[model samples]
Target: MARLRRRPRDPEGRMTLSEHLREFRRRLFIAAAAVIVGAVVAGFYYSEIFDLLTDPFYEYARNNPQVDASINFAEATAALSNLISLSIFVGIIGSSPVWLYQIWAFIVPGLTRKEKRISLAFLGATIPLFLLGCGLAYAILPQSLSILYGLSPSGTSNIQQASMYFSFVTRFILVFGIGFLFPVVLVGLNAIGAMPAARLIKGWRIAVVLIFVFAAVATPTADPFTMFVFALPLTALYFGAWLVCRRLDKRKAANRPDWLDVDDTEASQL
Candidate 1:
């Protein structure tokens, strides 16, 4: 019987489990430090960040005579806590590259050359796709707010809790951003040979239905227009991913000899 060969270890000598833990701790410390620095910088410009976050609400209020948009803090510590939390959020976003790189550095040594290439490609694609999703959410915010605000009775002013409002906005942005990465994940699966493009294409109708249902549920606004606003881009991205997977599958097939390929009839016989 023949034994399978193990792949070579990384050039850096292997260490005990304790050393790995220490390395992880060091990387975590660096990432934490970067976040702290970012938070400090963000703290200096808290007012600007606050204004930016509240712009959509203000714009909606300005246009609608009946809807008065104002955020209130119910507790004494609410304002300070909210500001601190906002600064932390800003810090994390600002220091994302540093922390992300640190994480990648920690994991890269364990991966093979092909795995490393795929990981790098995935990382490269993920950031921009996430940012684009966030951008789309930001663009949709004004309309979403307007739609929701319109629901209030004519005489009642819309007063929102500051922390709650911030949470909602954060969740909204994150959901959209992460949702946009679905296609990227699909592409990555295809690239890794875990999911075939043909399977994805075959399930197009179901996929579209699920996408729309998700958009409807995920969107904060209770309006069809906003649902479509979220769904349209995702639908486009899904099809785009399908095309990419199809091309990759074709390329992979092209690299193999024709005789090695089995026709459907031959495959059925086996």
Candidate 2:
């Protein structure tokens, strides 16, 4: 039987289990440190994220003549709280690369060569999916705001509190961000062999149902338009993932080692 290649450090040595705990601790510390630094930097730019988010409302208010357009914050403390919250959110998101890298590095020692390659592909696709969702949310914010604003009564339709406005936008961005990653998750499942490309293609009808179900469950707004907007991108992404999986599966079959196929299948099925 042919043997898998070993790294210099490994010298064909397998992990002793105790080393796994030590590595986990080291990666955790690095991830935590990165989070703290990102939080501080994002806190410094808190006003920017705030304004960047709230700019649509400001624009709509400034241009509109009939609605007496302005957001009214009821409490002084709300603004401060919003800043702190926004900073923390930005920090975590901004630090994702650092934390993600730390985690990948820590786990690399335990992974086989093929697993390492799939992990790298997953990391590559993750950023784009997340960004796609965030951009979609930003693009749709104006429409959402218009709908929300138009529903007001005769004389009293101002945003009475910053909390209300922030809550609305933040929820939209977050929901969209997570929702966009649906395709990536599906691709990862295929890469890991828990799901096969052929089976997923066969189950497209059920998959469509699941897509809507995810959109409905994940979306914070009950508005059908907003919910549909979220679902549509995910649907497109799902199809794109199928293409990627098809190519990847063909490559895997072409490159698969026959010796590992038999026993490994039984182990995995177990």
Candidate 3:
């Protein structure tokens, strides 16, 4: 008996459009489910998380007698809402690896072997960098709170609303965490040949300016010190990425064939 011929496959593996859609849906559902599970787990630790989140403010208040720190719920449902919101945020963060893995799995079949290696490296770097950024933000929270709270008139107590405080803290942490990933993205682009080291090096000045601007904007406080705290590390990371890209470009150039070195003008004339 004759055997049936298999369908042709792309170098990166082949799938129909419908198959891709179904795969995407499956991955999305899994990621969502992971987040939900994380949230449920976090809900049990709501009080602990709340205390941990408020610790920075409390610490600042402790040192400064004039500054009064107390979080109040304005509405009847405000406390419950805050707890749920905090749980969701915590859940997403805690389950990041699961969702991130799902995303990577969904895309891996379409990537070349070398691309897959690079992607795995990126994934490894991303989680640590994000956690580092979050840690930095958490470390700076007390100082930031101190500066902002110090601005209030003497003898006046600062009554922070639970919802507003949580929102601010969440936004602050997320901004820093996401901001730190910018360099990883740059490196990934370079690895994929979408961006060359020369371009990044040439645009260093603009990149520095943008980094500072982003830091300033992302910082909850208007203080220059806080802005610098954010910008300095990010700037360092960007230059570090540039150095890596430069080295990569050199390696590529060394391996390139002489015939491939034709000038752009000469190639166009040909």
Candidate 2 lDDT tens digits, 200-234: 78988888889888888877666677878887877
Quality of model 3 by C-alpha lDDT = 0.90
- Kindly give the stretch of ten consecutive residues in candidate 1 with the minimal lDDT sum: 261-270
- Residue-level lDDT for 110 in candidate 3: 85
Position 25, candidate 3: lDDT:
98
- lDDT per residue for candidate 1 within 1-270, as digits (tens), equals 899985555585465687679879999999999999999999999999999889998889789766667889989999999989999988987787788788887888777777778778878888888889888888889888888878878688899999999988877887898899999899889988998999999999999999999999987667888789889999999999999899989998999676667776575323
The lDDT for every candidate, in the order shown, is 0.87, 0.80, 0.90
Error of 1 at 182 (Å): 1.0
Candidates arranged by lDDT, highest first: 3, 1, 2
Off by over 4 Å in 3: 1-11, 262-270
Model 2 poorest ten-residue lDDT run: 6-15
Candidate 2 has a TM-score of 0.84
Q: Which stretches of candidate 2 lie over 4 Å from their true place?
A: 1-18, 256-270
Q: Point out the higher-scoring one by lDDT: 1 or 3.
A: 3
| Number of the predicted model whose lDDT against the real structure is largest | 3
